[model samples]
Target: MSSALPPASSGQPPVAASPLQPVTAGILTALVGFGSTFAVVLQGLAAVGASPAQAASGLMAVCLAMGVLGLGLSLALRMPISVAWSTPGAALMAATGAVQGGFAAATGAFILAGGLIALAGFWKPLGRMAAAIPPALASAMLAGVLLKLCLSPFTAVAVAPVPALAVIVTFLVVGRFFRLWAVPAAVAVAIGLTLAGPGSAGFDTAALALPKPVFVMPAFTLEAAVGLALPLFLVTMASQNIPGLAVLSAFGFRPAAGPLFRATGLGSMVIAPFGGVTVNLAAITAALAAGPDADPEPARRWIAGVTAGVAYLGLGLLALAAAAGFGASPPLLIQAAAGLALIGAFGASIAGALKEEADRPAALVTFLFTASGLSVAGIGPAFWGLVAGVAVMTLHGRLGRLTHP
Candidate 1:
């Protein structure tokens, strides 16, 4: 025993390892990312008029694109830069409902949005313009867009009390004790209930199949381009990529924004014909890999992103199963799970929006208008929220300067 437990010469205690290893953190990040939002993505696609097959293809395409881009960018920059399908953009698509030319037109809009994102990298002015958006307003708009989804837990409970309540309760309990595992755990409960509860048709594991690409030839129209593409690009940049970059910077990794944007844009373009929406830098999930828990050495944390990418690829292969399960389950169950998953994000966005007192009023206006689900000239509330918020802030600033001067 004495020989086996060699006593330390020094009086100092030995250092303990981190609770989370890089690989474990990576796997957790992937699970949280995909588990939390995949249902919402499916709903969003359906809202925009994607058929079952098309939606399944979109899910697979997005998963693969995000995986490949996440891996490539993380390796290239040697930074834990994770890419994701734009969750906010998907939400916007859902809110916007079916467009003029149907899902094909929506696909065209996706391509245009991706192209604009790529252009932002090449054009300094455009990038600067996106950057110039007031942080408070941007966060407000994001919060507003998420408001409806965040409320779905309650609504789901009303619709299907037993299953939805089970998911909700599980999420709350798990989130309190093990925050990261909340969504995945809730998802597990939902799946369990779906398979075991009365009137349930047991899940057929054998039915799991590899996702196949289904091309939707894009039909671009000015309405789709203006109504869908522009707003999608804006929200994806303002709400997602910018915050994702900020998260990296916070962790002392200064990845080049231009190249990262370009990479995601290119990935989105490649997947667009196959029903993928915009691929972007991940804000929420990026934190999981970029933080100290992933690895003490900043340089080594890129491995976490690579691991997450591999996880995403595996999930992509199983997209057909997920699509089928979600498609067959009660919509309320999916909504409840998604709403619970978004609670943290919703809270963060609201806090961010209201942090500065001077910007509070403008931020509130933005949030209200966006949450109101207003549409003008076929354009959705997100664009209007941005416009209104900026206008209010601008006017307030000008008036204050005049008064003070």
Candidate 2:
């Protein structure tokens, strides 16, 4: 593993430069880049019965809202930060609604949660406290969260071997030559095959349409908000922003903690009232935008994120349909592409954790706990790993003190 690099704000801070010109082309390219995430969103809608029109409309709403916010805020902050609806949160809500009421109330819950985020961001102390978490813990949490998504492609291969293999092979080929457009190229191959026949195999060419927002008046209920808000915060922090910070730091961008949290907080507030839940800084996508492929000129990568945002706006209307769409197939192609795309990131995370010898045990524990696929008392592995690692470390240190004395 490479020696751990200092945090973005740790080393010499770059002379803050003027914002790069918006790269419309790169932005346009990135939307096509994250095609799989879009697919997953569609699949979630399908799970929710997300219906045809509502699915379409909700997806468009999510895409557009996220995209617009991502572009505007990213540009405003002069950071390559991107935005996306919380995938983990959406899954939670989809499951929640299935047993609870419906999406409408859940969306209402979404709004309340956004308010909580804004509160967290508004108070600088809380944000700083969050940032103070040990680097290894944060990295482990991120790796564990993403490892699940990274490994999911193999399952896809089982369902649709031929198509998945094709996608993987194509991705590897494009990765060798095209470099910048590698994963995108793989996705193109997958989309091409799917449209060739069977499931959603028809090419329906229609120019994209903008989303019409539906405002759900905030009905403040402690029951709804209490149930929904904490979970939203947890998903955003653990699944969304934490990884985002990891990506930012990985690519040598300074982790400007305050503004990033503030932006997510505010963004969540805007869309939560309308039906968008779990909006947060898009760490995974931001890595895609900030890295070499985002743009030849690193300065222009924010535009890639911006372009993704615009695509989000365009697709926001079909939110549920989008999730269903991804889940619709054996999803071999999506899995293949997403896995190949994240390979670089996964490597980086593992490398990051292994750097400090003292940190290795904790990191390994985290990775195992996360990859173990264990859930206890209704919480995921992230919390559990942290609990175990920290407990062990504290006890070991105390025992050493006692022995020395």
Candidate 3:
């Protein structure tokens, strides 16, 4: 499990490193992580009935939590254990729509979810259960949750053809060469179009204000707990935390899971009352810092995480500006950028779900149900999708045994 980079073939040494390699990687990871999904987070908060101010508060809280936790964990563990807001959890919230008590109820559920995550750190069984979830089913559930948002680009193009197309084309072209820069490039184009488009006058630069915390007293309700708390925990664990662990393990960095989970969970709880939903280990951005590209020496890779954490703190300061920009821009433009950012995640989830032939049927069932947006009671399609997939997988296993016997 040595994380050392492979040695050069010849006697000559590898290229001399720039001191900025880790720093650059950290900055890139933070940029990609924040720019790619902050819009989606705002949209998710809105779907759950957050006022513009409340949503801004939530965004700020999560950003600060992530930055602080990421920095602390990286320094303590000396591993690139990047932390992030749960994009899948946000997507699940978006799918759940507004609950009985509206945003307050949802906030309560968020608190409960964060508490559950923190408890899971002390409860070995809970952590084990999360880890034991079939990879196919987990991946399928994530894919299902992501499907709708990923399609927003097309929807945006239909509603606002020229601007959406410009963004889309820019993404495709830039992604072809500099894959990492694709979403940022698209975001820049979308912003440019928004500033120049017909309704541009509505974006009052003077009105843009720094983000401030808008606390909402949480009111716990049965419906919100069942609908939001349970699903949020599941999606965050399945789609974000587990995958994040896997990414780190792939790079031969196996820090204790309980401490990591507890750190993020506590951070989430600290910010929940302020509108932060959940923060967890980051899967996508972790790879950028953990990889050899960040540092030739694996032990030194933690520097990238530390750098990213510092960068995230800077982004947190600009949360208000980001909120204002998204608020003033055309919804389609925001949707288009968010959708483009998630395209790779969608593809990865699909591939992960279908990688095993035996699990394909179950995975497809999960994806279909989740993508269908079916909600029974207050529970979202994501939870039901997991249920369906596991049921199918179990039945398929039993049938195979019987036939073979």
Best-performing candidate as measured by lDDT: 3
lDDT of 1 by residue, 59-119 (tens): 9999999888888877877888788889988877877788888999999999999998998
Better of 1 and 3 by lDDT: 3
Give one digit per residue, the lDDT tens place, for model 2 in 1-405: 221232256567655423433455435444643453544444444443444444555566566667777778767765577777776555434333331344555556666666656666778765544545555655565566557566655766787778777878787787788665666777668667765646663544331343345555555544445444554565567556777778777766675666666766776767655555557777555666666545445656666666667666654544443444344444556555656665665677677767777667877786677556555544445556656655654555632332234
State how far residue 94 of model 1 sits from its true place (Å).
Answer: 2.0
Estimate every model's Cα lDDT from 0 to 1: 0.83, 0.58, 0.85
lDDT of 3 by residue, 1-405 (tens): 535466656978677778899889998899999987887888789889998788888998999998899898999989987999998888777767898898999899898888888888989888877767787888888888888888998998778988889999999999999988889889877877887788665555643567899998999998888778887888888888888998999888999889988988888888988889899999988999998889887888899999999999888877776776677646679767888887888899999999988889999999999889887787667778888987897888833442244
Q: Which regions of candidate 3 are displaced past 4 Å?
A: 1-3, 6-9, 206-208, 398-405
What TM-score would each prediction reach against the true structure?
0.90, 0.68, 0.93
Instruction: Flag clash pairs in model 1.
Output: none
What's the best-to-worst order under TM-score?
3, 1, 2
Most TM-score-accurate candidate: 3
